[model samples]
Target: MNLDREVIKALAPTGVLRASINLGNPILANTSKSTGEPEGVSIDLARAFAQHLGVDVELVVFDAAGRSVQAVASEQADIGFFAIDPVRGAEIAFSAAYVLIEGSYLVREESPLLHNDEVDRDGCLVAVGKGSAYDLFLTRELKHAHIVRAPTSPTVVQTFLEQELDVAAGVKQQLESDCRKHAGLRLLPGRFMVIRQAMGVPKTRGAGAARALHAFVEEMKDSGSVADALQRHSIEGASVAPNEA
Candidate 1:
């Protein structure tokens, strides 16, 4: 299956399908060990899309989601795989969601913030990956918490290791990975947001390309290959219902 040929032909000559990584989540990291090749749910899904489309997966690593979306919106990349937000949806064309995510908070086991409701209540210092979906969501939804945006998930994890902030927040998968790296860190039970992860295509691209890609994803979901890929990479908490998308 010559994926590149098919994807290029489908994309037309003017477009380059681009996929970037939001360095905020280990499971979604371009360098994650689970898949042994920057494998994660998003990476596997994107690769599968590329394979099914007969295109080469052009993987781009971005420090944050803001830059990633910009790549898609500016037509630098034809599509992106990441957590979907209503605000981001307004900027780019999003396909039907392929996965569901729960936002979570990470804290040190002994930190006062672990027990103090007031810390989570209002104006508390919470760390987040800068320019990430969590950053946007935190700023918009967490009115009571003062956000300290870290440049990357590692930075956020490092800060949490140092006990410099009360809590760090991001997707549950990321928080779980962080907890593994830092023994003292633990994830809180509640979710901050429920995210529907999807693919983003530039609005500048022809509608047909978006529709084609959407159909390809739908087919992958229907085939059960998507769930197989996620399980192969050991990605937990991502619900893959056959043909659900």
Candidate 2:
């Protein structure tokens, strides 16, 4: 469990651990309703990781997943929590997932779409957060459905309603909350995809740094820190990822 000096230096070159926090993913990170400051599972993990490195933590916040990914890939951030995708893998070294979330589809209750499969029809239009994991996954999997991109995951439902799109795609928890807030909206029977949420470091950080961060994440998962964060944050519709070891 020794923290390597070189790894720490690489991870926090500025003597501060800059964590790329995406507030768009409410289950993982979000603005505190009362304080207006950032707080959530990701923030908890960022603080923990920073403490392990004996460095101060700095949050580089973003409103969308794409911008978060960009921050880490471009070395603007030391580490970040991200949904694993091969597209993002090129510029980032990803640890085994510490959590998993469901990517779901939402439609008007009166809409004819009853199942996840039914949303891929030729005339179907799906509203998705631009550069989100759901957007990336669906872009590859769906052939006939046209994707209408929204500015962020939180806006997907609003965009869908305004544009009169056929379906909205996002995290199951987010969709569920939206369904309750707006009413007359329903989630499909099952999930469209399972998002593997993991810790990531810029690949340019070197193999030693990547391995160190990966081991840290694995230890956090095995130690139940990830589960505790989810519970502490009252995050539902998501689960801790299984320990890889």
Candidate 3:
């Protein structure tokens, strides 16, 4: 593989790759309790990309997807991992996803909501991480329910419990973990959406960097690096995304 110095410089102007890590999504990243470093599939991918570039990585950590998106949009971080969303696409050039994760809802066991389709009824208060893909999707698709924005996806379950929300929408793995941690919480039978987890660079980084990042993701997917990262990180409920045309 040939390195494009011009594209590398555009994407990593600081001479090092700055990757924004969103700790709010446990499926992708979290603070390791023992090492206190960001550890997950996202971190692994970041390091791999830096290695490919023959550069070092600096992780700009945030507690939510919104903040990570803000970091790249403001050029504070050269690149970020994010869900593919049209709203964010306006400011960021997204690669095809290397992983796919399910988005689902969680409710108190005794709640009347028994299915995914039942969550959109009137009087249902859905709690979601602000600026999350689920929040954006629900904002557009929900007809009757009022959405309560939480600080982040990791906190949405706690907010739902505290606020007595009718539903908590987030990554299925996260909701499942919450259910196990706290009794009387149950995930809906099925998923509401499938999140396409992709890496993005600021649109201002130019087309050259965008093309490079896109190819990088596709190569990783095809070479099994993405799947290897997922297994090495002990990730569950995520699978390598299919190659895109």
Instruction: Please say which candidate is ahead in lDDT: 2 or 3.
Output: 2
lDDT of 1 at 8: 56
- Candidate 2 lDDT over residue span 37-116, tens digit each: 99999999999999889999999999999999999999999999999999999999998899999999999989988989
lDDT of 1: 0.69
- Residues 1-245, candidate 1, lDDT per residue (tens digit)? 23345445645344334576555565555564554455566777677666666557777767677777777777666678767777777767777777677778888787665442445566568888777778887788765778887777557777655657878877787778768876777777767677777777766655666676677777767778677777786778877633544
Range of the 10 consecutive residues with the lowest summed lDDT in candidate 3: 1-10
Give the residue spans of candidate 1 off by over 4 A: 1-16, 32-37, 112-120, 161-163, 241-245
Stretches off by above 4 angstroms in model 2 are none
Q: What is the lDDT of residue 185 in candidate 3?
A: 87
- Cα lDDT of model 3 by residue, 110-202, tens digit: 998899998889899999999998999999999999999999988999999999889999999988888999998888887999999999999
1 or 3, which is superior by lDDT? 3
- What TM-score, computed on C-alpha atoms, does each candidate reach? 0.82, 0.98, 0.98
Best by lDDT: 2
- lDDT accuracy of residue 187 in candidate 3: 88
